[model samples]
Target: MTDEFAPTRFSHVKAGENGWRSDGLRDFFLYRDLGVAEATEGKVICHLVKANMAPEKGTGWHRHEAHFQIVIMTKGWARFMYGDQDTLVSAGDCVHQRPGIVHYLYDYSPDMEYLEIVSPADFKTVEMPAPAEVPPFTPWS
Candidate 1:
């Protein structure tokens, strides 16, 4: 039997090695690449995301085209909706987003930050109709 998978290498990303960039999926947030994509040969991606601006309008209803994905809240908190179910992800919280699950991130704190890991490095996010109304975001003082 032949192995169908390419070998992956060890990767280490030190803090301050990569600066956060605004060219992420959302303009209201910044992303810091953790060097996992290159090391894994595009098989996966790991990154840290943090709020860049106040949440006037959060990430609208959308879903990602990924086989596996998870968001681990590292700081602050965020409120998300998974098909009409309101979920508040606080610091140290982790959420596994099932593939093709329609969701919305409607609110978050000023210091909200999370680590996101997804398979297949490159993923497509498709916008979808809102399942329910979103709540107002807390004003940042």
Candidate 2:
């Protein structure tokens, strides 16, 4: 195998193996790292995130500074504004967020949960003004 495509170490994580903590992206969403960050040595990071505390205002328009990112909804559903398009992501739905694509997650069900995988364990988020008028946020109970 090429050095760039190195053989990653073995990693086995149970669903409840790790504890959840507040995510840097949003305080209302809790995150649990799946050990991919350490296993890959900052090359990639995988984590499970779920709704913890409902916020009056949801995640506004923002973009992540990374090479790649993807989200797989594990439970419930969420509505997001991807550029000029409004997308509804439900359980089992997977979405690949292109680099630097601005998006706003405006609404979600109470049981919202997802698995996010991104390249580079440490990434940056840039908040930007909405390209279009955002819809009213519906609070999650």
Candidate 3:
């Protein structure tokens, strides 16, 4: 298995190269792969994630089963509950979410979009209880 990804090659995904698709991550977000998963043979996955639906209810508290994970806010802003701290990640912000840190993305702008990269492409997500009750979402229009 390791031999297959021994020499991870390169990939060039140009603008509008890959179309968006709905996986099982979030019902309101659409993702476009950047060919990192195939290039690295499931070692890493890089993709652009965009909010496609309104923020009626954001992603509930959940933790990813990954060794490394990061989100770089490229457009707009998003409110997230990281552990017990409520953070607003805006454009130009990069967040390195340590593995197993419970978080809830509760609100975001219509143009909210970010680049998310994670290790072990086929990582798992385990739903957990929220650390604290989340406040009402602020209007995002």
Candidate 4:
């Protein structure tokens, strides 16, 4: 593969959380593609998730290695916690984070929804330093 990688198409849709569920939340996983695995090289791994927050619950802190995550809130509102800072992200707003950063979400509105994208394609290769104490939501802080 050259420096350029094939683009994957993603359509906004509703989905449910996988493996682990949080706060009695029925989450969703919209779409994901990492260049069909073999074709991915030095490229970004794209993921799209759609879910709604019911009340005062939020995702837990989590850390990533070799991946930069960019969360785009298409609808609703949410408060993102990265390190010592907390930022409220609403519809049409996006949050980006570098690798190995400790981050989490708090005070998610009842109608919060977002899409998370990871760069470097090899995101799956990252190993969690420790099993996230909280299921569904993993908090590093």
Candidate 5:
């Protein structure tokens, strides 16, 4: 009997192999696909995201419809509001965003970059209302 699910294949994405593209979820950030989704046959997705421009208006309040999601900051820092609490995520920090939790990334440094991993590869993001007031962003000189 053949199994309904196909086996996931191994994947190796060398540095500089795939170019960063601006056609991601946010226009202000660039995304570099790491080939994890393809290798896993849509079971998961891993990608690197970097700032494309200075902070003006950050990502509006939104929630991702995903079973599992995490962000690992690789450089710089960012400010986010998860529910009513404001949290700062910096380099070397990791944040696991619980499924359906309302959050918003309100500010970030110019060099901010992070590795994001999510399940199901193709997740949905729904806009949400702000839970509280967001702090002002630091202006880049």
Candidate 6:
């Protein structure tokens, strides 16, 4: 019997030529949206999202339909807003999100870098919910 070999899904993504990819912000923001490699149908899909958010530039309110998110702060600080709950996660902190739950981030500092791991990769690719416009710099007050 011969063993079959399967290739790994990912490799390190280098930063842009300028050493930073602008996210239309002054500071710097970049990400790698791992598509189908992390999408495991009928069971769980994982999105290995590594994001570097500029100061005061963060994501909007969005919710998952049949997926859950496990957000981990690997670099700086970020405030995660889930409905009426305000959670501040720094490096080494982890946040879990349930399906149908609305959430977003704000008050991200210049040193903010985080990773979002989504499970059941059931995120809506076409009709993704847009994040609500919340007052910037006031996610956790």
User: Candidate 1 or 4, higher lDDT?
Assistant: 1
lDDT of 1 by residue, 1-141 (tens): 235555677899899798999999999999999999999889899999999998888889999999999999999999999998999999999999999999999889889999999998999999999888887888788
Q: Rank the candidates by lDDT, best first.
A: 5, 1, 3, 2, 6, 4
**Model 3 regions more than 4 Å off:** 1-5
lDDT of 6 by residue, 31-109 (tens): 5443433333324443333345444545556666656667788777777777767778898888877767777666665
Which residue ranges in model 5 land beyond 4 Å of their true spot? 1-6
Judging by lDDT, tell me the better candidate of 1 and 6.
1
Off by over 4 Å in 2: none
- Which tens-of-lDDT digit does each residue in 1-141 have in candidate 3? 487657698889998898999874887999999999999888999999998888877898899999999999999999999988999999999999999999999999899999999998999999899798887787755
- Local accuracy of candidate 2 as per-residue lDDT tens digits, 1-141: 788768477789897788898845789899998999888888899999998866567888899999999999999988899988989999999999999999999888889999999997898989999898777767644
Please report the candidate that would top lDDT against the real structure.
Answer: 5
User: Per-residue alpha-carbon lDDT of model 5 for 1-141, expressed as tens digits?
Assistant: 346555687899999898999999999999999999999889899999999988888998999989999999999999999999999999999999999999989899999999999998999999998889889989888
Would you give me the overall lDDT of model 2?
Answer: 0.88
What is the C-alpha lDDT profile of model 4 across 1-141, one tens digit per residue? 543434443333234423223432224322433232333444555544444434334545567675567888877776666666766789999777777877665555545557666666556432233233322332232
| Candidate 2 lDDT score at position 25 | 70
Each candidate: how many clashes? 0, 0, 0, 7, 0, 6
Ranking by TM-score: 5, 1, 3, 2, 6, 4
TM-score of every model versus the real structure:
0.94, 0.92, 0.93, 0.55, 0.95, 0.57
Q: For model 3, what is the error of residue 6's alpha carbon versus the real structure, in angstroms, after optimal superposition?
A: 2.8
Computed on alpha carbons, the lDDT of every model, listed in order, comes to 0.93, 0.88, 0.91, 0.53, 0.94, 0.56
- Each candidate's root-mean-square deviation in Å? 1.6, 1.5, 2.3, 8.0, 1.8, 6.5
User: Model 6: clashing residue pairs?
Assistant: 44-120, 45-120, 45-121, 60-131, 61-131, 61-132
